[model samples]
Target: MGQDISQIDSNEIQKMLQKFGKLDEDNSGALSAKEFMQIPELTSNPLVERVIDIFDSDGNGEVDFTEFIRGMNSFASKGDTQYKLRFAFNIYDIGKNKL
Candidate 1:
């Protein structure tokens, strides 16, 4: 049976993944869109599209590793804050600007 996830810190898991970049040591600044699809946290988030937009530095329909890393970092640092605030809007709209 699968472990119960109610105790999980979803945000932390998502942030951890966001901290790591796609594996590509060739100095190539691109990651296939397929690679992005493999991320579990991304399955439910529109951030996938956002990252793709940011990573496609050349607008060539692809993302290099460096660009991918940067995109993830931005999302972790900025996007996560926004997402949590969005979720907590009814409770504390102030969370939006704290980050």
Candidate 2:
């Protein structure tokens, strides 16, 4: 993720902020796994725990706005195919074992 946070458009930032707000039901300024799972897409995802683990760098069992923004920015970046492929693999191979 060579792209700087400044590179993200203002509109996109606002959009992501809105999403964060929606997910943070308790308004604690962070997303607990229960709150995160509120999203219908994530509700059924088997790897949701790993996804949170990858982004919740502080291990506080919650994802703050900054962490949320950074993770979303990387996911949203329009970068090289190889970079995207590697990211996909990282998500797929969260167990660090051969598939």
Candidate 3:
């Protein structure tokens, strides 16, 4: 799922925004878990809840546009491998103790 953030040009961002708009069924300007899960890939993912938790940096239980962008950036391939590993670790670190 990793992609280069630097490779995300304005067109890519616009595409992302468009996709977000489509997923935001309620037009609330934020995506609820149910809304986020509407993505076909996520629909069957067992770790979907954890993924949402990781993306929702503010712990607000919803992902706004900014949070969505930040979360997507975390998966950028050009990012340090250590950072990616840490991000993956955070997804599985249920206890948050850096196990």
Candidate 4:
């Protein structure tokens, strides 16, 4: 079976944070739309903007480390297929925010 994402340890989290740092080009401790687009994984994702919009909880127009990790954790949590789907929907739902 694939490794459980929620089981990721500190080292892995650190690595992810480091990657996030690299993606945050302006050193603003947050990822703006342009910076987010620079990530190869998200390059072709049509919903990248929506995903960032959803995760940018502070309505700051950027995703900070906390919001980033929270969004990641939502995906990482152990769950059945239905639960995972719900999580995805919940995260992807950008309420009251114009995109």
Candidate 5:
């Protein structure tokens, strides 16, 4: 469990971007909880607040695609324990956060 799922790869980045762009209803590069809940698949996470918690570093109510990437990069930085890395990311979205 010593992994950080935030270490998204190139493919994952593309997917994330596509999903983020679609979720940004205002055509802005950011999204809010209201905008996020619109995603059918994301309902499973139920921890959208946590995602917002991490991505919204500025304590803002929303996150821009740039902010998302920045958060992902920081959480998934090299030298992080595998479990921590995976824990921070969706590597194993079993709906549980354990390390």
Candidate 6:
């Protein structure tokens, strides 16, 4: 989970920031569940709520810029396989117990 954000291309980071801004409709500097659901890919997913909760690392009920970046980074092709595995495991381990 300690993937370095600096490893991501500057252009990619800028693009992600811009996307995040667009998703933050209320300009609250964080994305609410409604905002997350605005993404078409997530709208139909049965696990959307759990995905959002995982991304909202602080359990603050919203995904802030840092949390958003970290979550996205996990799926980056260059990210560590072990880290990605752990992240994916966490996503499906709804019980909070390693299954």
Top model by TM-score, which number? 6
Cα RMSD to the true fold for all candidates: 11.8, 3.0, 3.5, 5.9, 7.0, 1.4
lDDT of 2: 0.73
Flag regions of model 6 displaced more than 4 Å: none
Model 6 lDDT per residue over 1-99, tens place: 345676778877898899899999999999999998887778999998988988898899999988888888787787778878988898899997888
After superposing candidate 2 on the true structure, give the runs of residues whose Cα lies further than 4 Å from its correct spot. 1-3, 77-86, 93-99
What lDDT would candidate 5 get against the real structure? 0.64
Candidate numbers, best lDDT first, in rank order:
6, 3, 2, 4, 5, 1
Clashing pairs for predicted structure model 3, backbone only = 3-77
Single out the weakest 10-residue window by summed lDDT for candidate 2: 79-88
| TM-score per candidate | 0.42, 0.74, 0.81, 0.69, 0.53, 0.89
Candidate 1 lDDT over 1-99, as tens digits, reads: 012223335675565444434433333444566765666767776556654554465667776544444444443534455443443342333332535
Candidate-wise lDDT, in order: 0.48, 0.73, 0.77, 0.69, 0.64, 0.85
Which of the predicted structures, 1 or 6, would earn the higher lDDT when compared with the native? 6
TM-score of model number 3: 0.81
Model 3 over residues 23-87: C-alpha lDDT tens digits? 99999999999999986777898998988988787888899887776666666564567656777
* Candidate numbers sorted by TM-score from highest down: 6, 3, 2, 4, 5, 1
Minimum summed lDDT over a 10-residue window in model 4 is located at 1-10
As a whole number from 0 to 100, the lDDT of residue 36 in candidate 4 is 75
The CA root-mean-square deviation of candidate 5, after full C-alpha superposition on the true structure, stands at 7.0
lDDT of 5 by residue, 1-99 (tens): 222445567776787788788889898778887887676755777676666666665767888776666554554445355534554674335354543
Query: What clash count does candidate 1 reach?
Result: 6
> Lowest summed-lDDT stretch of 10 residues in model 1?
87-96
